[model samples]
Target: MSKRIFVGYATKTGSTKETAEAIAKTLSGRGFGVDVKPFAQAGDLGAYDGFVLGAPVNGMAWHPDASAFVRANASTLAAKPTAYFLLSLAYGVGRASMKRAIPARLAPSSALAKPVATACFGGVIATEPPIVLRLLFGIKKGSPRDSRNWDDIHAFAEGLAAKLAPR
Candidate 1:
């Protein structure tokens, strides 16, 4: 059977989706079949050989749907090789904020799954949106910052692929 790699992401305005797509593309280029899906739509993990979970930080924690997915699938996840990525504003901040904000934890199941290689990427902060939508959602835009380190992300993906490849 073809090796299957599943990428599950939680995105607010698409940054997380982009990051997941990048990883999926890289893995697919290496010959693995990749299935990319939002966390809510992702179903059983039993069919995949490996997994990549990506999420954005909001109010200092993972998005609820991502967390819920982890909680719901922890057992199945624990049986496979998995990795995680976090997108947040802490990327450009000084050492203190970076230390506190980055390296957010994955759900327990993911942690228990094969050792999880993780990446912390800087995310986009939308400056303006429709006022009505922002008001209804209580959205507050953060300052624009390029916090993503493409080199780091690429390295992490490469390393994870290497680790998950057939022995």
Candidate 2:
């Protein structure tokens, strides 16, 4: 039987969900049974063999919903082959310091489950900044830009599949 994997994500906008979908598609293509869902609807994790958890980076930290999920499921996650991915403008549109903060920001999640892999992807900004951006960065308006690198995203998923492949 193919291994079952859960791809659960939280998004302030929708970039993280989109990234999670892409990850799920790649994992499915590589012969795994993948289920994609939002963090709030992550039911019965024990039914899955592995996990791919993702969330957006906001206010220089992992989204609270994803962090809370990690905290709540740390025990189950630590016992499974798990990976994490984050989406953020820091990926391609921010200063080096912001980019440098990604690992530190991800430390909380990794400290819990010690994932097999972790990735950070560039995020998409809509024509109007989302509330999170306005509240966090005080950006009231902006041009839309999609900075996601499909090659990097696909590669991250492929590499994660390799790491989590059964013996």
Best by TM-score: 2
Model 1: lDDT of residue 129: 39
- Model 1: lowest-lDDT 10 consecutive positions: 134-143
Q: lDDT for every model?
A: 0.71, 0.84
lDDT of 2 at 31: 96
When superposed on Cα atoms, how far off is each prediction in RMSD? 5.1, 3.2
User: Tens digit of lDDT per residue, candidate 1, span 36-124?
Assistant: 99987877777789888888877657777777776777767666777777887644332454445456454443454544577677666
How close to the true structure is residue 9 of candidate 2, measured as C-alpha lDDT? Answer: 96
**Candidate 1, superposed: residue stretches over 4 Å from native:** 107-114, 128-144
Q: Write the per-residue lDDT of candidate 2 for residues 1-167, one digit (tens) a residue.
A: 99999999998778888889999999999999999999899999999889899988887888999889999999998888989888887665555666666667789889998899998887787765666655444333453367688999999998988877642
Estimated TM-score per prediction? Answer: 0.80, 0.88
